[model samples]
Target: MKVKCPTCQNEVEWKPENKYKPFCSERCRLIDLGEWASESHVIKGESFNQQLTPQIDEFSEDLPPADEDFFKH
Candidate 1:
């Protein structure tokens, strides 16, 4: 099977032998990585931090409060 590269739109062969299957070459793959690393590409959804904050807060509430005695033990 052949697919278009996500970075360059070049034709790519989809196979195990092709290290960069979705991309034409390593350069194109790295370009896509750079875009993601720079936040130029983003998934459409609620922010991950926002989603996790409530869960983290709920978990923290169940933990026992730290006391000065804890340090002494």
Candidate 2:
């Protein structure tokens, strides 16, 4: 199947034996990877809530105190 290059938009023929697959060559493939690594290609998804809710019980003030005696020894 023939397809246009996503970067340069040049029409290129696709071959199954080509390791790069859709991309015409290694350079084009690397350019695509670089874009992804640099976050130029964004994955669209649902947005998470900005406010973080505490998982632990608010009333429980039972955290163990740090041992300063260990360092002193």
Candidate 3:
């Protein structure tokens, strides 16, 4: 089968003997891997916060008691 190398976009003949089936050669395959490792190729996905809202404690729960008679005028 005929396939284009994902890195160079060059047409290459695919054969069972070629270890890098989709890629034209080892160089191109390694280049593609390097790009991914360096974050050049990023996978787009939703954020974790958007998927799950965080649980927060109520603000009133953190305050001292209002009934304390500290101000005696």
Candidate 4:
């Protein structure tokens, strides 16, 4: 089977041997990663922060209070 690379739109052979099957090459894969990392590519939906903020706020009071040594083990 063959499909277009999601990052470069180049034709790619879909096979287990192709490490970057969905991308044309490592460069294309990295480009896609950079886009997502920089927020250039975002899925359409309610922002995750927006969705979680209310839940977090509701539970904040139940969490143990933090201190300088909170994370110590």
Best model number under lDDT: 1
lDDT of each: 0.55, 0.46, 0.52, 0.54
Quantify how close model 3 is to the true structure by its C-alpha RMSD in Å.
Answer: 22.9
Estimate, for each residue in 6-59, the C-alpha lDDT of model 1 and write its tens digit.
Answer: 987988999999987789877576556535443553212244225443433332
Worst 10 residues of 4 by lDDT: 59-68
How well is each residue in 7-60 modelled by candidate 2, as lDDT tens digits? 557777888787665777655654564354435542111111122124322212
Candidate 4 global CA lDDT score: 0.54
The TM-score of predicted model 1 comes to 0.52
Candidate 2: the clashing residue pairs are none
> Can you give the TM-score per candidate against the true fold?
0.52, 0.47, 0.52, 0.52
Q: After TM-score superposition, what is the CA distance of residue 4 in candidate 3 from its true location, in Å?
A: 0.4
lDDT of 3 by residue, 7-72 (tens): 889898998998886999775765565354434532122332233223211211232334223212
Model 2 ranges off by over 4 Å: 40-73
Better of 1 and 2 by TM-score: 1
What C-alpha RMSD separates each model from the true structure?
A: 15.9, 19.2, 22.9, 13.9
